[model samples]
Target: MAQHHKKIYPDVEIAMPTRPRASLGLENGDPSPIRWCHQASPSLSLIPSPSQTPIQTLNLNPRRCCCKCLCWTVGLLTLLLFIVGATAGIIYLVFQPKPLNFDMTLSARFNVRITTDNPNKKIGIYYEKGSRLSVWYKDTNLCQGTIPKFYQGRQNKTVLNVALTGRNRYGTTLLNALQEQQQTGRVPLDLNKNVPVSVKLGALKLRKVRILGTCMLIADSLTTNSLISIKASSCHFGLKL
Candidate 1:
């Protein structure tokens, strides 16, 4: 018989008993309350969190959002401009101020005097610089000058005086015509004047517009240093933008 020797096991390597093999029904381990709960719990980790959701999955489109905002802003600005333009149009229509009416008081050799009246009841006229005053006989422009800028009140009249010199080329012809007209006792004259003006209606003031006046007259003579008589006179008035 072989003699059996007792082995001392202290500090010697000992193999651990093998764990029982998991049942076929259990994937990782034996079933337990904790384990079943952990397996059955909704897959919160697999489901994306709000912060971790894919950018493409969001309902918003960045390009479309920007386009919508831009369209709204442009539409609003267009509406505002339309309203402003309509309001200005209405104001212009309601305030149709009359132009200035002018008449010649004195027309002597190298001297002219004019008087003007504002016809509108509520409209005031403010004349700016760059005015022109001229006299004509038939097709000849005899003299040219400038009128002083001034403001005319409603239904008010203003007088102006100017010294005129004839054009060098036409001085002799103009003098001959004047002498002939004096002998015939009937002289035809044309006067034209233009000035830039601002119109005031009530408390509202408008931008500058041009005031033009043309007068056709039948005069008795071209007397020097004496007031000439006007037999008949007709004037036409207009405004230019």
Candidate 2:
């Protein structure tokens, strides 16, 4: 029996499973010396680091990023405004909008002919409502009218006919004075206008703008029975800005 126990034994050594050792410096830490930018925190917290000196940190998440978002939005808006202003200035310089030209006649009422020359090749004008026109003589408004709504094309000339008719308290006095001036061959009158309009640039339509104008004219007569002719006229018209 002792001879049989010592006869045949196969397995002798056993190995217990163990975690493999880290190799090739993969698990130790980041080896490169370059450090990533650290975000600054508003919390009263302390974190240990190798370098004690306060490094310049980005305030990326300050105050939960609310103030940062607001500042970025404001900066973007300001930049957009500056770009728009520059583009507008360039457009103005290259294609200057010319002032309108006016011609007039009187037949108991004022008949005005206006000519507009738009310079922008891509812009169009749309005359809106709330338009007004007036004629004055010696601090008295003699007549008033309106500019009929219409659309004007780009880089084109447009003509308009406006009739101004009204009555004043000093009609008789004004008639006498007009007759006296007609006798002197110069009947002075001042013409004014305020017209609201919209502009179309490319695919965008702008807000209403006031087109203002003033005309100084010398006429031969103001009576319906007599022939009324404009002698000398000076007119100026522009956008009210």
Candidate 3:
């Protein structure tokens, strides 16, 4: 028989194996430890913030505007006044009245007569000192006595004979003669029937006189007597010796 070796086997555990545990606390069992973490603070610039933009200001000049307005107003007023003045002047000229020019005749002529009554009376004829008688007219003296020369007829009344002539521009002679006659007092004579007689008197005065041509007597039928007064008071005649 061979000698047989006896094998020995190790003993095996009969229970399950347990896992190892990690400790999260200190050995003295204090509160759990705080975890430390590093993080960068947010970066910020120190430059000053942009300054607020300066507010824009609008500029206004009241004095300049007022001056311009005043100048324009004064100019307008002056123009209006000028227009009004011009209009008024034109109106005055248009409405004004026109002046009149008068023309008159300078020369003219008329016929006249004269008479007297005293036979032995010396007659003295006078006229305007500056006026001249007509070329055909003349004056004669009959006697040196105050009365004219004449013969008493069978009627026993003195009859003085005288001849009168009138010829010239009536305007000059009549006005001057009448003015002079008014200054003297005497009676004018009348032309005889044998002599051709032409009588010329103021036409205007005749209507006033209304006297009978052949006689010195007034006609009662006439309307005006103004000429009678004018003739009697404003006219005279005499004989030149």
lDDT of 2 by residue, 20-59 (tens): 6343344668575554567897788777685985788776
State every prediction's TM-score relative to the real structure: 0.49, 0.52, 0.18
Best by TM-score: 2
Cα lDDT for residue 193, candidate 2:
84
Each model's RMSD to truth, in Å?
A: 26.1, 34.1, 24.5
State in Å the error of residue 82, model 2.
Answer: 96
| Residues 35-121 of candidate 1: C-alpha lDDT, one tens digit per residue | 322356665547879998878866899999999999999999999999999998898899976789654232334567878789899
Query: Ten-residue segment with the worst summed lDDT in candidate 1?
Result: 101-110
Q: Name the regions of candidate 1 deviating beyond 4 angstroms.
A: 1-110, 119-121
Report the C-alpha displacement of residue 188, candidate 2, in angstroms.
Answer: 0.7
For model 2, how many clashes?
Answer: 0
Q: Which scores greater on TM-score, model 1 or model 3?
A: 1
Clashes of each: 0, 0, 22
Give the lDDT ranking, best first: 2, 1, 3
Task: Please state the error at residue 60 of candidate 1 in Å.
Answer: 99
